[model samples]
Target: MENLEKAIAEIKQALPGLTLLEQEPLAAHCSFRIGGPARALAVPQDVSSLARICSILKEHQLAPFLLGNGTNILFPDEGLQELFLISTEKLQKLFLLPDGAIYAEAGVSLSRLASFAQQNGLQGLEFASGIPGSVGGGVFINAGAYGGELKDVIESVVCLYAPDQGLYELSKEQCAFSYRKSYFSTHGGCMILSAVFRLQPGDREEIAAKMRELNEKRRAKQPLELPSAGSTFKRPEGHFAGALIEQAGLKGFTVGGAQVSEKHAGFVVNVGGATSHDVYDLMLHVRKTVYENSGVVLEPEVIILAPDYKLEDKGPRVHGNIVTVNGPAEE
Candidate 1:
């Protein structure tokens, strides 16, 4: 904690113009409306400022956590006193490349990207219209729904690799996308800056219609009205998480103020005044029950950040000589 305090002080002195929110409550930033205060959360205006902040933290042998749209996250009520968070909310650069592909920054929401694609008569992004995460978060977890994933449309990604404070661009194959994950998901030191999406041309009206149809389906099936992280658990290989949960007779079950949604078994909504302990305990019970009922294990889709949650530094990977960030890079 002392190290974190010193690092925070250094970051403030280094970037005087940065918007650093100290002791900010995590609840207001996330979709669940649950979570205690984070020690320090910095919002950098652009990728350069973000990189500088990371470089400062690295100097202190400390690492920072990047908070995206805060959709699929469960931050504990006890708070993160030892952690420094960097929010991508201000990295809102979205445009089209000269080569007819869409360019979006880390903070650009998936819905907005899909809308932009539609307005430009581009297809293939309609499936992401209702996903409540930003481009960075979507790419982190190869987020998909209704038979579509970001990996399918993403052409390339640019990121700042923290270990060396250098920038690198990775192709779709290098991203190593898989079900609900990407290389960036498992690898540390890589902070997503932006991405270029390759999409096909289609009728503007038809694209809009498709997006509307998908959003309507989402609204009907998801517990959007309630305060909850989208889905509590990932889909098990041979079966759906919701189906197995329902089959185990755990639907609509409550622990404190947290309950498996009566509307959608997949969601664990905060009925009212739910604490993080309540949520953690409830999810534990659900996992144990589901595993006992069906021989399958359920993995949480939500990124739970308890007071003790810490990510081990996995060092870094070598990004080839295509671009030397410190030498000559975009950001």
Candidate 2:
């Protein structure tokens, strides 16, 4: 605690005008609305401020967690006391280039980005219209919906690589984007600053129609009214996580305030006042049940941030692969 206080003091001196809060509740930052308090939370106003804050933390030998919109993360009930939490919420600068490409800061929401593209007659980002995360977080995990993903439109990224406290521009191929994974996922201590998206010109009416269609599909299928970290588990190879849970008869299963969404088996929602422990326990139970029934171990899609948290399963366990279900999996 003494070291933390000293570091905070140094940060305040180094970066004036930066928003700093002590013992801020994580629930207020995350979409799930369930977590304990963070020791210290810092909000950077822009890329330069973010870089300065990162440098200060590095100088003090402190590793601060870079938080985006916090849509797909689970913070522990005990809270984040070990690391300073840095949020990109205020760094939301966006503009369009003359060449028809869009440039957006990390903190810009995906929905806003898509809307911006639509307003300018750019077509490719319609799939992101309903995603509830910042551009940085979306790109970090290759966030996608309705068959389109961040990799599809990303032209380049400006990132603050923490190892050297240097900024570097990485091309699309360099991002190494795959299904719900990216270079950021494997590389620790790197912060995404902004990204340039190369989108093609299209009719404004057509783009808006597409976005509206996708949003309706999302609203129809997802439990948007409830608080969730979106999908609980990644889609297992050759199967969907929701279908597996449904097949295993685990839909609507509850552990404390956390319950599998009856409306959509893919989500584990905080019915009301759910704790991180409850969500974690429910996730474990769901995984075990699905594995026991189908012989395929489901991997979590949600990023769980808890002290000493580790996956109980070593990896996916496939036992004598065979058809366990009668028909094709449902979305």
Candidate 3:
């Protein structure tokens, strides 16, 4: 707490132009519209500014909790008083290289990135047109839908290694992408700066048509009208989570404001006034019932943020005011 206080003071003096929100409401910033005030949320305009903020936090022995579009995370209603947050909201630099690869900052929404690709007559990213996450978050979780993931197109990633205060560009293979997981997600201490995507050239109208088709399918099946994270649980090996959940008779199950979506069994929607605890309890119940019925354990896809309410399978997580970045989580 003392170190966070010191870092906060130093950051104010060092980067006056940066937008620093002290005790900012997390609900106002996330898609789920949940969570209480964060201790501090810093929005950097570009990569260098973000790096500078990380540096200051690291000096204080703090590790920042990186927030993207907040589509796949659950924050506690009690608020994160000791955590320092870094938002990729303003890191919006995106363009194409002369060699035809697309370069994007962490903050670029996946939908926008897909649209940009379609506009340039690029194919392959059509499946991402409906995913509601930024490039950084998408890359972090290898966000996928309709048979496509960010990993399929991403060629490289440039990130800030917090431990050394240096930058490293990792190749696609080095990223070690897999089913909703990545090097960045499993390994801590590295902050994604930007990424390069390689795509195949295709007819513009054809690309747009494919994107439209995928988005239409997504809208028809998923609960776009509700406030919720995308998927509540990862697909248990060889079995679909939604099907298993529905077969367990948990369809439309509710705990307070949180309910399993009747529209799609995979999603847990906030009908209204849902607290983080509401979602958490509902998920726990779902996990319990589903396991009891199906003999398959479900793992939460949503990143729950609360010291006391951590999932049993939780790994190296950075809580508190000290922002430590990639140490050994690096490789």
Positional deviation of residue 164's Cα in model 1 after best superposition, in angstroms? 1.5
Candidate 3 per-residue C-alpha lDDT over 1-331 given as tens digits, one digit per residue, 9 for 90 to 100: 8989999999999999989999999998787789999989999888888888999998988888889999998888988888889999888888999999999999999999999999998898999988999998998888998788889999999989887888999999999999888888778877898999999999999999898888888889999999999898888799999999999999999989999999999999989999988988888788888888988888778877766555455332222211122232211
Q: Decide which is better by lDDT, 1 or 2.
A: 1
Flag regions of model 2 displaced more than 4 Å: 310-331
List runs of model 3 lying over 4 Å from the truth: 310-331
- lDDT per residue as tens, model 2, 168-231: 9999999999888888776676689999999988999999999999999999999999999999
Error of 3 at 188 (Å): 0.6
Q: Candidate 1, residues 1-331: lDDT per residue as tens digits?
A: 7878998999889899999999999999999999999899999999989999999888887777888999988888987777888999999999999999999999999999999999999999999999999999899888899999999999999998877888999999999998887888667668899999999999999999999999999999988999998888888788999999999999899988899999899999999999877887787788878878987777777777653422122112111111121222111
What TM-score quantifies how close candidate 1 is to the native fold?
0.92
- lDDT at 64 for candidate 1? 79
Cα error, candidate 1, residue 170 (Å)? 0.8
TM-score of 3: 0.94
TM-score for each candidate, following the candidate numbering: 0.92, 0.93, 0.94
Model 1, residue 322: distance off in Å is 33
